[model samples]
Target: MAVYTYTVDNANLAVQDLSTGESLTDIFTYTITDSDGDTATTTLTITIDGVNDGAQQGAMKSKSWSQA
Candidate 1:
């Protein structure tokens, strides 16, 4: 039996920007090695879909006013 090991050159992927009906593609390289010291490398392509996020808010304060 041959034991195989897999490795990825880059595993840290950034999140895609928010858009309407848009997607992003990211490419990376990976390698597979066997117990016989043979290695196979190839490029992998991944697609990231766009999503909608809720609005961001900041801190709020209260003030008092008087009228004469």
Candidate 2:
């Protein structure tokens, strides 16, 4: 019997500064090691979709203009 361990190069794969209607793609490397010191590596792709935040948008204000 052989024991195998799996690990990801990037533990924190969170997206930052993403805005609405924007998308981001990130690639990460992962490896699997066996008790015999044999290892296999591959890439993992992650896609993050942006969302709209209503609170971030301010309320619309109305203004009136008069002619002098």
Candidate 3:
């Protein structure tokens, strides 16, 4: 049997959303190694959707809402 662990860091991620006419990129990478001296690596990309609220907060907000 083998063991694996993963970690993430987003200190440099953009604070804007894609729906606000802005786009951001987040890259993820992982590596695995076995006791038999075998190693493998992989990468993944992710994109988040922005809210369409009618108000602008000068930056990306964690929450948003509208009144009818």
Candidate 4:
């Protein structure tokens, strides 16, 4: 297993390569406090999907394709 951390601007969010072997979901919380004793909070969700990345080595037994 591995862990990755990222820093982003306040209006930008992005994630990639999250469908590898170790698919998992995580929640991150951020809090900001202003000088006038005001505060704001934000929540972000990180989700990783499980997908087979390896290719078939043998002859093609069957195949199918689709688009949505």
Candidate 5:
């Protein structure tokens, strides 16, 4: 089991926790909002190392990947 961390970006929203059947120890959930008033949700799945971060240790994982 691993840890999944991420932050929702938009305008203003609430934080939540969700389990998408991914094999992980800890999981973080956030809400996405739209200042312009958009009625849709943007799913940000935090992965191990996204954006090719040099020091991904302190980076957010917002991506989706098939469990192995």
Candidate 6:
């Protein structure tokens, strides 16, 4: 099975979130102006899938007895 997972690494993500609304707005505007900014700065998504695998079988035991 092939699943897709995204790994995100944004050092400034937490700091940006902690910043105020005005700060965010200014950051956004500056980001637009500076094309080299962290455009995709933060959270990533992972896709998890469920696959169907057939049932399994168990082992069996046998015994033999003799009488006289």
Each model's C-alpha lDDT? 0.62, 0.65, 0.60, 0.60, 0.41, 0.36
- In candidate 5, stretches whose alpha carbon ends up further than 4 angstroms from where it belongs are 1-24, 39-68
In model 3, residue pairs whose N, Cα or C atoms come closer than 3 Å (at least 3 residues apart or on different chains), thus clashing, are none
Per the 3 Å backbone cut-off, how many clashing residue pairs does candidate 1 have?
Answer: 0
Best candidate according to TM-score: 1
Q: After best superposition, candidate 4 residue 29: deviation in angstroms?
A: 1.3
RMSD of 4: 12.8
Candidates' RMSD to native: 8.5, 8.8, 10.0, 12.8, 18.2, 18.7
| Superior by TM-score: candidate 2 or candidate 3 | 2
In terms of lDDT, the poorest run of 10 residues in model 6 is 24-33
Q: Write the per-residue lDDT of candidate 4 for residues 1-68, one digit (tens) a residue.
A: 32558553323222233345655566889777878999889887876555554666783588789999
lDDT of 6 by residue, 1-68 (tens): 32544443334554323422322221111212234664534333343332333344663467899998
Candidate scoring better on lDDT of 5 and 6: 5
| Model 3 per-residue lDDT at 15 | 42
Candidate 1 stretches greater than 4 Å from native:
1-16, 59-68
Q: Which should have the higher lDDT, number 2 or number 5?
A: 2
C-alpha TM-score for every candidate: 0.48, 0.46, 0.42, 0.39, 0.20, 0.24
- The window of 10 residues in a row where model 4 has the poorest summed lDDT is 8-17
Tens digit of per-residue lDDT, candidate 2, span 8-48: 33334444345687877778787888889999999877777
Which lDDT value does model 3 have at 14? 49
Candidate 4: list runs displaced more than 4 Å: 1-23, 35-37, 55-68
Between candidates 1 and 5, the one scoring higher on TM-score is 1
lDDT for model 5 comes to: 0.41
lDDT of 5 by residue, 1-68 (tens): 33554555423221122224332232445455567876454455444321221444645768888988
**Model 2 stretches with alpha carbons more than 4 Å out:** 1-21, 57-68
